[model samples]
Target: MPETILQIPVAKIIPHTLEKHGHVRTDNYYWLNQRENPEVIDYLNRENDYYQQSTAHTKEFQKDLFEEMKARIKEDDESVPYFYNGYYYITRFEKGKDYPIHSRKKGSLEAKEEILFDCNEMAKGHTYFNLSGLSISEDNTMAAFGIDTVSRRQYTIQVKNLVSGEILAVKLENTTGGSTWASDNKTLFYSRKDEVTLRADKIYKHKIGTAADKDTLVYFEKDETFDVSVYKSKSKRYLIINSSSTLTTEYQTVLSATPDAKFKVFQKRTRGLEYSMSHFGDHFYIVTNKDKATNFKLMKTPEEATSKENWVDVIAHRDDVLLEDIDIFKDYLVVTERFNGLNHIRIMPWSGKGEYYLPFDSETYMAYTTTNLDFDTEILRYGYQSLATPASVIDFNMKTKEKNVLKEQEVLGGKFDKNNYKEERIWATAKDGTKVPISMVYRKENTKNGNNPLLLYAYGSYGVTMDCHFSSVRLSLLDRGFIYAIAHIRGGEDLGREWYENGKLLKKKNTFTDFIDCSQFVIDEKYTSTEHLYAEGGSAGGLLMGAIINMAPNLYKGVVAQVPFVDVVTTMLDETIPLTTGEYDEWGNPNVKKYYNYMLSYSPYDNVVAQAYPNLYISTGLHDSQVQYWEPAKWVAKLRILKTNNNQLYLDTNMDAGHGGASGRFEAIKEIAKEYSFLLDLEGIKK
Candidate 1:
């Protein structure tokens, strides 16, 4: 091909005006939203073809990059087996296989393995496939799993008999893809999403060897803003149904033995009151934000009387800590807490005796509880990793307080050394006088220099804290003298709930500004310069990337947005889209004038104007159910028309994937390789 083909696809303008809350706006590329239109498909394919042609020279570099990353990973790796009930379950991958093989050994890990599912075999004859929600029956004779072939998050559940080694004829369609088997093993409960909205609205009960059409509706959520799910409690005594929204939650439950029994309400849904439940002994433990516990507190109530009035404080709320999650065992209670932007696991005796936090030496390490299925076990299994460290599985004995390393991730076929890398946690002052934490890592040999290339990443939304975790793929950058930093800005619960609160809604711009400030901090500290810095994020984080570039287009040298939700105003206005209704609390109801104006202010597509823009790389999936592919498609088209710079802007649309790029392990790495090649090529680092 030519040195570089800059032929950009221009999507025909078909102006569609929308008036909401007395506000008038015109969208010329709105016609791209028609998924069934052949022209839309053609336009997207052309963009993909254009991207491929533009980067065709880097094909060899992309392949080498992929191989370099894949070589760091152990292809024939197996996850640490954990004992559950009477079996030791494990998932392993064959050396060249794209999918995992789930297997179990009866009684002990040394026993002969019984294969439960080979995803590679199951994934055959499909362009995209996802296997989730594997729930085995109480007796362990049968298993139920959810499979999605279309990448829309809609699943079809199937049951398999372990004894006969046959997938039974029992199939349930239009389900969330995993069934909760009652104590009887024959009774199952599963959730189903709406056909259009794709919201998990109704849950149904099914019996083994029965037709799906004859399944009985067990519970239905009438509110469009809430989605419901069903699962068996950890204690296996009760089948719990949970309905939740962005800011609130409600729970109901029935005995696992009685599938036909009516579910009694455990707690009524109170606006802004969000809580999760776990059953143990004779009580239901609740992690809730009740009584103005903004960081959340632990409360417990008798199993029979699960109302809010009966709740008694178990762990009082703390101002400095955020209770992220909990794992219960017969003898111990493991609490995953985030304090001072670090994850700490506190192991407490179920009898309320001595409690202590697991020790981690790194300043920016991530530690959390892993699978601990045995209720009577004294050992607690967890995971710990940092930017300079590979992920390690650990087992700590509660009684002795001694810990043993079970498995540390092996980075194969490379002269890798943890001491060769340096990681630091530094604070960057935000525009509002808030200190935003930035975790960064680079090669020890690489000194701080303004000319060094840097990639800054962040996902500051939904109160989801971005913990600094290790990535083998990141080695490709670090080995190339590139700095990788994570801007744990506002909208994430990294600091506290207030940190997230301050960064969302009317303050949503804080997320964007905080990221920009972090970039400036690194620049001021001589880590990198504006000319060598690149910003990246995905989904909502993609929104962040869009906003940052708009606010300061000259700040970044390049940018990548994956499955970005850039068209915020128009998307939030349409309630039919998946997750739009449930996210009103996160982004606010744009039907209100204030929110509408605020959203439109930063909506990427709406803000695209005639200006000098940064080199851009954008990607999306045609079958994406979360953020529709058209959002990025339209944004790129508008940018192509309006951008006043000769900088390259490319869009790669995955023809056979959804929200997540690709289903297979190796297939997903290709996307990463392509992205790395884009940035490396810009920095002239091609091998």
Candidate 2:
């Protein structure tokens, strides 16, 4: 495949006038750069004159621009096909379909037709389930799958009898997601959730074949905000029950499950470890800060805390960050930390004390926050990353203590010049003197200066890290003479807990400031100028992109917002929505004055006032169960009606799609086409 390289022109890239508008910190003003460029002043003066003369004509320009890009991509056959009918999927595309499971035609479900995994036949090829994830049993007699194409957000747990290839039991709709198969195939221990608050989940137990058909409510709480996470530890017999809930604004309740335990009264007023004799086990591991909620530590249970105590520091917490994940293997616990803007997976001693951080090859790692891991393989094989390096499958082995690459996605037939692309890791100081890291990837061959089209991306939310990996879609941009960069600022798990703490809650403005720092770096380093700059993000990232554009709309030529949560304050306060309760740990609960005011500070949707917006492309899916499509849809609609200046707000939505645009290869190809068409046209790439 031929890689796209940028052609830069150093001399005139950063017009002197551009450097004058430095970053100004204040919540009251967004898009602080409204000054006109002198060198591009003629271009700007004419653009402004046109905006004043015909306020409504530019909408037609949007159509013309998109068509132009579609034509250019047609000229260059290397671009991946982005379909519309269905978004892309994590497919079972291997070997010939003559085999049972593989035989199910690809895209069969696009028509809402039945797509089955020939359990009986496919299981024989060592391709059990012709799928992934946990199975019903080691014998492969029965199969359990997390079905998503059928539903959005909610996953239907289906158990099939491999011998008959029949679905024996199906839990049609469930908020209780992430189903795990218990040792006893007939008995499945799944976590059930009660959507009382958007902040947390309550769990239940389900029996597979019994008349007690309904999932039995087990460990539940009256608090509107509490999180319940369960694990079928390596012991294979004990189920580790972990629950965390914010008490007031800062305090919390952390509880663990014990086997066959009964609750007893305690004499000590507080700080005594609570336990039940027959329900929760004697051993318990929890994510707690007991000392500080912001920074967390993994703790073990005290055998007798009330008895003048045997309370010991099972895992003394780190002051730098919180424990993002906890995975257990043969008494060895794996704790993933968000530190130094990097996701480091650390192995722990049984006592949960000493930590040996595993060295990872990828610049960014999955916090292991979410994703199903293969317990038997001891291999960390699932997660997404796109940074200085190309996107790849990072498979780490626990047994051999080795790491290997599983796959690298690339354009099937295109020729790529990777050496022409160079990735630089640099830091830009925010107004608060907070140094933020930015990752840039561009074709080194195009040192012709600022002529290169640049794409700046970021998603600063929930303390999540923007990892380094590859993206075939990048080839669509890179192969077309464009450069790309990612902003690792505050509010993301990039540098760990301290990074997040600096940008979240009351300090949320740090996110916007850090993003601005990234854009400034691009100009200062002479990588690309305001003329060729474009910015993008989605969902939370959408909010980020939106904020950046508003903060400095004149600096960017085009903006992309995919299902952005710009309406943060409104959505967070609306209890009617989903996972709003489970989200408090990430975004502070806005109902209370402290967090309410915090959310209102930088909410892009609510803060939309009279301003010069950018040439914007807004995308959303009708079925996006996570961030409601209407949020972005309404934001675009209002921006169209509200912005006094003549700017493009191209609204796009897939009526049949969910958060994921479309499904399957064909549909995804169309989507890729649509996105690239719009982007290329905006950048003036010739067809």
Against the true structure, whose TM-score is highest? 1
Given candidate 1, what's the lDDT at residue 351?
80
lDDT tens per residue, model 2, 245-324: 43222111222233223323222223323221111245535554455545566655543442224434555767666566
Point out where model 2 deviates above 4 Å. 1-91, 94-135, 138-140, 149-151, 169-172, 191-202, 211-215, 227-229, 244-290, 293-339, 343-411
Instruction: Point out the worst 10-residue segment of candidate 2 by lDDT.
Output: 11-20
**Candidate 1 CA-lDDT value:** 0.92
Q: Clashing pairs in model 1? A: none
In candidate 2 the C-alpha lDDT for residue 176 amounts to: 41
Q: State the RMSD for candidate 1.
A: 1.3
